[model samples]
Target chain A: MRQNRTAWFFLSPSLIILFIVGLVPFFYILYVGFFDWNAFSLQKGMHYAGLENYRRLVFDQPFINSLLLTFRFAVYAILVQLVIGYVLANLLATDFPGKWFFRVIHTIPLMVAPLAVGATWRLLTIPGFGPVPFYLDRWFDFEYSISANASQAFWTTVIMDVWHWTPFVTLTMLAGLTALPREPLEQALVDGANRLQVFWYVKVPLLRPIILSTVFIRLMDALRTVDEVWMLTGGGPAAATRYTGLYIWRIVFPKTDYGYGSAMSLLTLYFTILISWLLYTAIGQQRRGER
Target chain B: MKKLITLVVLLAVVSGFGLTANAQDDNWWATAAAPYAGVTLHGVSESTPPSNYAADVLAPQFEALTGIKVELEPTSWDQMYDKAIKDMEAGSGIYDFVYIEQDIVFSYLAQDYLVDLTQALVDHPELAAPDFNFDDFTTFIDDFKNAEGHVFGVPMEAFVKIYLYRTDLFGDPEIQAAFEAEYGYPLAPAATHQQHEDIAKFFTEYGEENDLDLWGTTVQAASGHSSSFYEFFESIAPTFGVYNWGINEENWKATVENGGQMNSDAAKEALAWWVSLLQYAPPESTASTWDEVAATFAAGRAAQGWVYGENTAWIASDPDRSQVVGQVGVAIPPLAEGVMEAAEAGTGYVGYYDGGAFGIPHSSKNIEATLLWLQFIGQPSVQPEWAAAGSRIVHDATFDDPLVVEMDAQTNGYYTLLQEQGYLFKGAPAHPFHAQVRSVVEPFIWQAIVGEITAAEALDQAAAAADEEMARLGYGQ
Candidate 1:
């Protein structure tokens, strides 16, 4: 009891800050979700909306569209990142000169701010004056603009997400690759397994745990992409890129309808929690199988 | 004898300090603000030229005179609204003064977030500055007032959106000959909507054939941004005779079923016309806001477009900022044959009267001090410099201010149009659910632009959504 009290006493400052910064606003949002409230209106005050907001959101087609878009974007972005990251990790796993320099270079995009990254991409993909389209036309003789078309806007954002975050996946996989036990691979080789077979059967299974954890982290981030899309297409080309996160932002700020926005956000939170639990269960099941 | 000499020296030093203090000509601000001296006032505004000038130039001058500090936070539009609204919503008084866009004042009033400046000025008449003539502010001030005619905010910047074209291109004899031959009319300032369309088509073809990196017009139709939606509803729609963007004033209805004209034939034609112009605009136009449009015109890419007058001084005359500085010309935006008459009858508007005001929030503890600051900024003496910096004039006297007169000449008489025809333009419709309505309509407009839906379909969906939103907000039940 004394140790528990001491532990809590030491944690009290962090607990207070965490409650203020993280938990309090979330709970406030949860509370606000239950009422019909406008963010800027105080005279009308909050009307006890009960489940109307939730019902409206659940039946909202645009809301459902945004959810599907976000899910697809996350899946696409994660898969692309994983493939690129795996290829780079494999290359780095082999002995090479100045390998650390290449690794540092790969990780540079991770250091810069996401907003800046988005801005850079916005400028680069500009149709007439920007270097990306300019070079594409001048060198490759291609006539295209990523922002002018809805599908291109969606795909361009996915590409941008892939570019900015693939480095993280690469580094995570690199760590896993370096920490892999060499005994299994050597034994497999002695057992007359080819490099491809050894990698597929031994290395991949050993790396599954790391791969799952890295993917889970990236899935969360990809599911909540707001800044890049805002700077790039602004959820544009006909609301084609209006992901769920951007939709929530539009509601909370532009619409200034806190009740509907909070309710929608609470649903998003539930989905996030659900995904986390599912991933954790999958990881637990894989671990048991490995054991 | 030594003690007596020291006393005499101390007396001389004290008197010298008093003389220096008297020489500081603060015009009584130092005296009035003496009590609040050292107290800091926080304000937030969007990062526009006028707001920046107020923050960088006027703020320091006021601070130096009054000994009170001003911390002005200039940020992006979305973040600025979020910060100001959140502060007012929480009643935390994070900002003593908030820059209120003309469109959002109704909602703010409905929320009771603003201090009643009429009462503040009356109660603290002694603190108001001499040159702060509330009456001299143009009709733009009406946008910042309540239905009871009580003023809530001090107008800072006000101007009409005007049609800007490339003067050099318009004057080129060879181009004129080609335009006449192609369109059977002499190339001149477009007076009708059809003429504007013809000019856009001519210049687009002209640029393509000549390969001069030019387009016909710059459209602020960035499908993803609120700016595009605003340009369509406020600047484009009314010009096509779709008044109030199809809101029924009598019952606040926005659906065709309720007698609203959002999906009317006229409005659908207007939307189709706007989307049709996209082919003539630069390819990036589908992803453009006012900022991009202005930049494109400044870079000599677009021949003509409806541009905000606040950009006139810099884009048309400031050589340091604009590449086609001397080539820019301004005229009243083209309207349908009857738009001007309808606008006069209070059924529509010819163009946008865009500006903003600074209002003290009710949550402010230093309302008195903030009022003094606002009045100081509102003084007629400060109008010219602010106008020169921002290309927007709120005071009547500013029309004749020497610097403004010079810019009026420099921009080929852009401000002349403002001084003469500013009355034709209108601000956003006064609605308490301004943000909510826009949120409903913007995406549909975007989809219309991108061909996912026809203009009629988009408006039909938008009208239904707006009606639902308004009803949900407890209005027009």
Candidate 2:
């Protein structure tokens, strides 16, 4: 009982902070989710909107469109990041002169702020006047302006996410490779396996956990993407780039519709939680089977 | 020891004189602010030049005179609105004063978020400084007053959107001859939509043939941002004979079917005209904002376009800021043939009058101290300095100030245009539903801008969405 009391006492401060900052806000959002509350309106002016907000969310064209776009963006961005990270990790895995310098240089994109990346890309991608476009047309016979069309802007944001985060995946894979047992690789080589076969059969299986973690984290962060979209497109070309997170921000901040926004936010949270659970379970089962 | 004593005495006398000199400046209202000297009055405002001046210059002077400390927080536009509205709505009393833009005043007033300055003045006459003369303000003061003539805030900054063109391009004899031959009109300040279109087309062609890095004009249309919507409805629509951005006067219905002209034929034509100009504009036009638009003109990329007046002074006169400083020309924004007629009927405005004011929110903890602060900012002596910094003038007298006069000469009477033609323009219509309606309607404008939908289809869809939104808000029942 004394030990339990001491443990409880040690946990009390964190518990209070969590309750105040996390659980309190969640419950309040839950409460507001049932009503129609505008910030500038009076309490008397507020109405019990009930499940109307949620019901409308199901039918809300913009919200549904944004969700679909966000999903597509996440899928493409993760795929590109995984492929690029794998290539970079493989290249860096070899011992060479100036290896550390090259690795650091490759990670420079990841170090940049998202807004800076977006703004820089926006300038570079200007169709005629911008240097990137100007040179591409002159040297490579390629011409495209992302801001000129919706679909184009969507793809550009996906490309931007890939460019910004591929280094994270590369470093994660590098860490996994660094920790790999050399015995399995040597044995695979003695068994007459080629370099490719040894890497595929031995290194790949051991790096599964790290790969899964990197993919899942990037997916979640991409789904809630806001800053890049804001700085680059402002969710423009008719909101083609408005991911779920930016849409929620538009609702809560500018529109001041806290009730509807809360409902949408909670629904988003539910989706995110479900995805996380499924991924965690699936990965855990795979690990157990391998063991 | 004697030398050290003499040095200390000399230092004391100099320091004392410096204190007295500073004290005399704010002494006019020092006694009233004496009790509040130690107290800190907090405020939040967007990081505009006027607000920065208030933070860097006015705060220390006020603090020294009254003993009240002032801490002014300057932040980005979105954060400024968010902090002020959230604090006011939650009744947190975190801010003693807040910046209120003319565009958002309708909503602010509707929520009763601000104290009635007229009533505050009556309630505490001692808080009102004698030099805080309300009449010293220009007609723009109406932007902060309710319909009942109750002043809710004090005007701080006011500017208009005006027509800016390149004199170098417009005055070239060979280019003028080519324009006349091609369009059957002498190239001058555009008076009709056709002329503006012709000018844009001529400039783009001229730039292409000569291998010059030039375009017809810069359009402040970002396909996905609120900036595009503002340019379309506020700046472009008014020129096409659409009044009050097409919201019906009597019923506030935004749809054509409901008697509002928000999606009227005129508005459609206006959108079409605006969208067509994109082809002649630089490729970055689709992503262009007010900042981009100003930069484009400054770089001499655009021959002419309607630009916000805040950038007018610096862009036209400061060679460091503009490559085309000597070649910049100012005029009224181009109007459709019948626009002047509609504008004269008081049913429409020539352009947007962009300005903001400072008001004491009802949730303020220090209303009396804040009231004095508001009056201090309103004095005529402070207007010229604020005007020079922000490129906006709140007092009529500031227009005649020597500094303003020099700027007027440099920019070819842009200030004079504001003084003479300002009466022709007004801020966004006073509607509490401004932000709400704008959020729902702007996507359609973007759709049109990006070519996803025709101008007519975009407006039609926007009108329906607005009708539904208004109904959902319990309006127009």
Number of the predicted model whose DockQ against the real structure is largest: 1
Candidate 2 TM-score versus the reference: 0.92
What are the clashing pairs of model 2?
A236-B224, B37-B67, B37-B68
lDDT of 1 by residue, A1-291 (tens): 999999999999999999999999999999999998875443377888899999999799989999999999999999999889999998998979999899889899999898899899988997767898888787999876765677878888999999999999998998999999999999999999998999799998999989899988998888788988888777877767889999899888888888889999999889877897888888889999988
lDDT of 2 by residue, B42-130 (tens): 99998766788889998887787788888999987777988998898889999999999899998999888999999889998878787
**Candidate 2 runs further than 4 Å off:** A40-45, A108-113, A116-130, B1-25, B38-40, B56-74
List fnat per candidate, in order. 0.62, 0.64
* Candidate 1 C-alpha lDDT tens digits along B221-277: 877778888898889888988767688978889887897878888888889889889
Candidates 1 onward: DockQ, in order:
0.51, 0.46
| Candidate 2: true contacts recovered, fraction | 0.64
Candidate 1 lDDT for residue B28 = 76
